[model samples]
Each structure stands twice: as structure tokens, then as C-alpha cells.
Target: MTADLDQGSRTPLVSVLIPAFNHEGFVERCLDSVLEDPYPAKEIVIIDDGSTDHTAERIAQWVAAHGSEIPVEFVRRENRGIAATLNELAARSHGEFLRIGASDDYLLPGGLQAQVGYLLSHRNKGAVIGDSIVIDGEGNRLHDSGMCDLHGADKRLYDSSDGIRRAVIGHWAIGGPVTLLRKSVLETVARWTEGLRIDDWDMFLRLAARDAIGFIDVTVCAYRLHGANFSKTRHTATRIVNLTESREVAMSRVCLFDEPYRTLLRAQAQFIAAKIAFLQRRHTRVALHLATYASLLLLSKLRLHRTAHVHAEGA
Candidate 1:
């Protein structure tokens, strides 16, 4: 009967932020999923990141056709990185919680509703993330789910009975669709690190450190794994460079000085980095990872510095 819901309401104002690049072929599917969401969203903000294709024009046509029935706002900007586009959208957002959806990805029906319910139940939890179904370029199911096992010295888990302090670091098994972050938590962290090649992991770690994360334990969205995707196009070296830089930045912001517990976290971070390095064929990083684990196992004081030595020698 009214536009604004009552206070203490379980219903949340969800702002779906879809940052589109040159995803003209797949952007429509993404928007359709959001618009068809069982739970009504307050707004759907799609930012065009300077696509050299017809993505913006198509989005414009959709906006004109749909109008206010589904609040779709389109903004055009010069080609900037995904991080910058997200930061800009974050600044312009007006929702209780924000869910970022890539133009290539789509939200499953009732996905947003389920997550909103969970976030309401767990008010203290600033985020709720779930697993996703992996799909191919032709919209064919590739995997039942995109969940990771994350086995290694750095393996991280979403739900741990051992408590947050005991959980492995840098190992939150979450995709962008799985996570719906409170605007407050995001505001505290400020905008994402613009121009950075990879900011999701860094941002997630920062948020997890400040507040405990809630896992939905369900596949709520479809994650598209395609050749034209960012990860596919970007060179392996670019990924390594960005990940290394972002990890350092995130660690600097985290407080790990008071406890031996930090040792576990450091070890986990090293393992995760090692996996990325392994993927990129950076054998030297893999060695540094093992050395870091060794230093931690020996309870050495110069754990990270010694690992740095390993990196230097390996290089």
C-alpha cells in the first residue's frame, strides 16, 4: 500500500550493481534475471564502462521500454577498470545492501530474496554469500556449482565451528553473486581500490576481518565461465601483479601483531598466493609460499621477511 516499507521490516532495499563492459551479447540475460527477481529491488544500477560495442545502446533501449516498473539507471563513463566503475556506483548507491552482478552473470530466481532474508535474520553479519552454478558461454551448465575445495596450506572455509579466530585466512569461498554486503560495512571500507586489477579478494578480506561472514550454503546465482571474460583475457602476469599488490595493501590495513594466531593467517595467505602463482606458472612464488609455511611452522620471528628471502632467491 505504501512505497517505503516499515521500520524493523525484514524486506531489504537491494541495489543490484551491474557494471557492464563489452558484454552486449550477454548483458540482456543478466538484466532479465535481476528484473525477474522474486524479491523486488529498490533499484538496479547498470554502469557502462565504455564498451566499444552496442552494450550501452541496448541497455538504453531496455531502460526506455521498461521505464519505472523496474528502476534501471544507466550511466556511461569512459573505459575505466572494473574497480573504478564499482567505486563510482558505490558512491551513487542508495540501498541498505548492495549486490554486485557482472554483465556476464545472472541471478537465479529468489536468490536475492533468500539472501535478504538471511541478512535480516543475522543483523550483525555484514555480508551473506552463497555458492553459484557455473555456466558456459552458450548458457550451458558446465558444473553443478562453482564452490571450491580450497585444499592446501592456505585453504579457507566459509563456516567453521572452530570460531572466526581459528578459521583460515584469505580463504573465504564466495563468489560476487554469493555476497550481499551492508552499505554500512562498505561505507566504512570506503570505495574499492580503483584501477587495481583485482579488488574483490582484498575487499572481502578487509570485511571479514572487521565482521564475521555468513554463508548462505545454497547456489543462488549463475556464474558464467567464458573465454571473453576478464580473467580469460587478462594476461597471467597482470593477474599476478594485481594480486600481489592488493594482498600487500590488504595486509597493511589488517592488524596481525598481537597474536600467534596471525601466524596461521599469514600461512594461509601465502598458500593462496602460491596457488595463484601456480596457475600463472610463477614457480618462484610457489617456493616462497612453501618457505613461508616452513617459517611459520618453525615459529620464526622473521616469518614474512624470511619468506621474502625465499622469493628473492627463487627469483
Candidate 2:
């Protein structure tokens, strides 16, 4: 734990890493939310990922205006994707924990304090994620993400690999932007995969495999859903191909030690492929993928049944 000299208290430093890319309109508001936080021990690291707009300039102006009130570091670089930018930001961070901040999103009041306190007290947790409220481009509140509802009523701790796998595979209950992770976890896992579009999800799975994750039952941040959000491209052919390839890469790495997990991942991949093929109107390809999916599912169930029968006989 690092002590804050100004506050004369023991508080871990939380690094807010913002990867800005062409978000000229909302970047200032994002910075404002972080700077206004009551948490005394925090730093902001902003990396402008080759924004052609005035995003970098806006960041500079904000820093100039509030540099004395808060610690802010800004970096400008050529066009790299989110993964590369996140890697660079993580390397530059000096905090014990890292919070990823999208330029278009803003944290709710007391978010940092709540997350930091939870992580500091819970030594066994590798990361802490909270619920988020969805907002439109103009910052109008849409609705809660219902993450807390999905996770349960109270704060939950996921300690087992199976729990993590099921949480990720079954519903994807954790939100990346609303989560704060221990920096040591990243050190152990190396860093984000440089070129993968789903790098956040992949990293979360790896971290969960290594250590426990915590869920805080509160709305800690606001996620902006705008026209330019990356998820809007989900139905595109290029994005579908990328999603399939990325899932394969992630599953290959994590499923190496567990056959059941591998089988489940294979089934998921086939199901996704079937959906893509159906969208493309390839009837033959769709049928083949669906058949493969069903067969894999049945095989997985049989394996589970055999294991259960053996355990029952032993009992």
C-alpha cells in the first residue's frame, strides 16, 4: 500500500487509464468525472490513440486547467487499436490497481473510493467489477445494465475456476469498463493480446483462472452507447469473422488443461458459426455447423454423465 503524503494516510493509488480515440465531444466530461472524485490517491493516464479530431487538444486544455488539482499524464501516439493503447497505458501506470476508462464514458460519484476500498480490504480478489448505468450520446440516462441483478443481490466473490468460466461463458456478467484490476494480475498474465478485438474478455478469463474476482452490487459507472461504439459492427461480416477468430484464440489458451472446458468451447464455436452462416444465407454451411454443435453438446453431456456415475459408484 502506498501512502498519500497530502492526506497523510495509507491509501493505495488507483490509476485511471483513458484510451482516447476521436472522442472530442465527450473526453472533457470523462476527465471531469475522474478529477472531481473524492478519492485523494489517484492518477489519470491518458493516451490519445491518433485522434484526428480535437480530442488530444481537449485533453491538453483540461489538464492545463486542472493540473494543479489532480495528477494527469498525457501521451500522443500514432494510430493503434484499443489493445495496443491499453498495453502502453498499463506499462506507464504507477498505481497498484488499474481502472480502464473509455473517453466517452464517465464514472459515477464515489466509484473510485468504493472499488479501491473493496480491493484493498479483500486481499484474495484479483479484480472488482460493479454495475453500470447506460447513457446515450448526449449523456441522458437510459437504464441500468442489470448486472447486479444477474450477479445477485449482495456482493459476491468468485473463487473457483469453474465459477469464473461459467460466469464468463454463460452470461458475461462482468463489464470491462466498470472493473478495477490488480496490477500484479496483469504482470503475471503478461499483458493484453495486442491485436485481438476481444482482448478484454480474454484477459478477464485468464485473470479469473489465476485468482478470484469480486462483484460490488452498485452502479459505479455510466457506459455511453453512441453511434460510433465498436459493438455496432457486430452484424458485419468482418466483425463476425474477427469474433470467431478471437474466440478461438482465447479458448485455445485457456482450455489447454481441461477437456470439459475445451469441449464446451467447441460447442460454443460451432453454435456461433452456425449463426453466422445462417446470416449469410449459406444453408449447407449452417446445417453442417448445427449438426456439429449438437454432436459436441451430446458428447459433453455424456462425459459429464460418465464422471458422475463413477463418483456415485465410489460413494
Winning candidate number (TM-score)? 2
What are the Cα lDDT values of the candidates? Answer: 0.71, 0.77
RMSD of each: 8.1, 4.5
Candidate 2 segments exceeding 4 Å error: 1-9, 146-161, 173-176, 254-259, 298-315
Highest lDDT model number: 2
Summed over model 1, clashes come to: 1
lDDT of each residue in 262-293, candidate 1, tens digit only? 56566666665776788778799889888886
| Residue 162 Cα positional deviation in candidate 2, in Å, after optimal superposition | 3.3
Lowest summed lDDT across 10 adjacent residues in model 1 is found at 149-158
Q: In candidate 1, which residue ranges exceed 4 Å CA deviation? A: 1-9, 149-156, 161-172, 230-235, 254-261, 272-289, 297-315
TM-score of each: 0.80, 0.84
Q: What is the Å distance of residue 33 in model 2 from its true position?
A: 0.9
How many steric clashes between backbone atoms does each model show?
1, 0
